[model samples]
Structure formats: structure tokens, C-alpha cells
Target: MVQDAASGDVVAAGTSGEKKPGFFARIVIFFRQVIAELRKVVTPTRSELLKFTAVVLGFVVVMMALVYGLDYLFSWVTTVVFGVPA
Candidate 1:
């Protein structure tokens, strides 16, 4: 729905019978939109990038340690129950 900004009335952008833009026109519009969006992007500083990378790596290491501990505990329990080690 399209709105009449000053009148505060809702309106359709186009009628159902109205033809849409052709393929080349659509491609041009797509690239225009992509460029507009890319213009809005902000790059992080080197320090901020380093901090983010370190935070991600630290999280991964903590997850690995937790998984290893749980796996070892389960393996020990299994060996005791089966009277055999893999």
C-alpha cells in the first residue's frame, strides 16, 4: 500500500493491470539499491576488529574444553558399565 503523506490516506502503488518495469529496468534498479546500501556500511577500526576476533576465538576454546570434559566423563562411565575400554 502507498500512503498519501499529506492527506494521511492509504493508496495502492499501482493498479493490478499496470505493467511492472521491464527486465533491464529491474536490473538497473537492483544495482542502484545495492550501491545505496553499500554506501551505508561502516568499517570497523583495527582495534575493534582484533577485539572481536579474540572474543570469538576465546568463546570457541571455552566450548571445546567443556565438550571434552563432558565426553571424558561419559567415556569413563561407559567403560565402568561395560567392563571394557574402546
Candidate 2:
């Protein structure tokens, strides 16, 4: 018998003594737990969702500008190293 870490239940494993739940039992238990958890989720209001979207978009734009600036700097360095064509 193996003791569960959180609940301290005496769980028995198969002959191998690995203490894992069987396949179908695990799937059913997983879905049951998922449904129980989904019942507790609190979705944000429309205004809050819009605010989050705006923040994400602003962050993405700033990252893009930073990447473009770095690309231009590297290109300038490479051009200078190889010298202007004419």
C-alpha cells in the first residue's frame, strides 16, 4: 500500500506496486476534476477583456520595434565591415 501525499489515503497498486491509477479510471477522474474546476472559473467583464487586449497589443508593438531596431543596427554593422559597394 502506498500513501497519497496530500490526502494520506492508503492506495494500493497492481502487482508491480507502481501505485498508478488504471487508464480508464484515470481518464474518468481527470474529466470529473476538470468539470469541477471549470465551475469555479470567473471570466472577466468585457471592459476588463478590452483592457487586457490593449495591454497585450501594446507590448507586442514595443517588442516589434525593438527587434526592428536591432536588425537595422546589425545590418549597418555588417555593411560597414564589408564596405559600401561603390
Candidate 3:
């Protein structure tokens, strides 16, 4: 029984007691919503993009180093456990 504030009607959660629209109609509605949302996007500045890229790269490098260290540690442990000549 949740009512929309502006329309004062019970908004169906993707399903009301109504028949679904046809396939073409649904597609048109989806693209209309997409265009509407795309209009609201604000592009980041060049400096902001550069800073975000640098942070992402730094995080990836740190994760790579961590995984490499763990891999090396496990290899050493296996060698010692089985006494394999390495």
C-alpha cells in the first residue's frame, strides 16, 4: 500500500494488477529512461580523471604484489613440507 508522494497512487513494484506492455513498447520505454538518465550525468574534469586513474593503477599494483608474495610464500612452504629439491 505504498503510495507515491507526487501522484498519490500505489506504485507497483514492477508488477501491478495490469497486463504487461508489448515487447516493442517495453524496449522504447527502456531507451527513453536511459536517455533521460544519461542527460543527468556530469563529466569529470581532466584532473579528476587522471587522479582516479592513478589511484586505480596503484591499487592494482599493490594487489599484484600481495598475490605474488603469497604465491612465493606458499611455494616455499610446499618445498619445505615435501622436502622437494628446489
TM-scores of all models?
Answer: 0.70, 0.72, 0.77
1-86 per-residue lDDT for model 1 (tens digits): 54566688876767434566789987998899899999999999999999999999999999999999999999999888897844
* lDDT (tens digit, per residue) of candidate 2 on 2-85: 666678787766534565778998899889989999999999999999999999999999999999999999999989899888
- Best-to-worst order by lDDT is 2, 1, 3
- Scanning candidate 1 in windows of ten residues, the lowest lDDT window is 11-20
Kindly list the per-residue Cα lDDT of model 3 for residues 1-86, writing each as its tens digit: 33466777987744455566789988998899899999999999999999999999999999999999999999999988899765
Winner on lDDT (2 vs 3):
2
Q: Who is ahead in TM-score, 1 or 2?
A: 2
As for TM-score, the candidate ahead, 2 or 3, is 3
Regions of candidate 2 where Cα sits further than 4 Å from its true position: 1-21
Model 2's alpha-carbon lDDT is: 0.88
For candidate 2, the per-residue lDDT at 65 reads 100
Model 2: lowest-lDDT 10 consecutive positions: 10-19
Off by over 4 Å in 1: 1-18
In order, candidate lDDTs are: 0.86, 0.88, 0.86
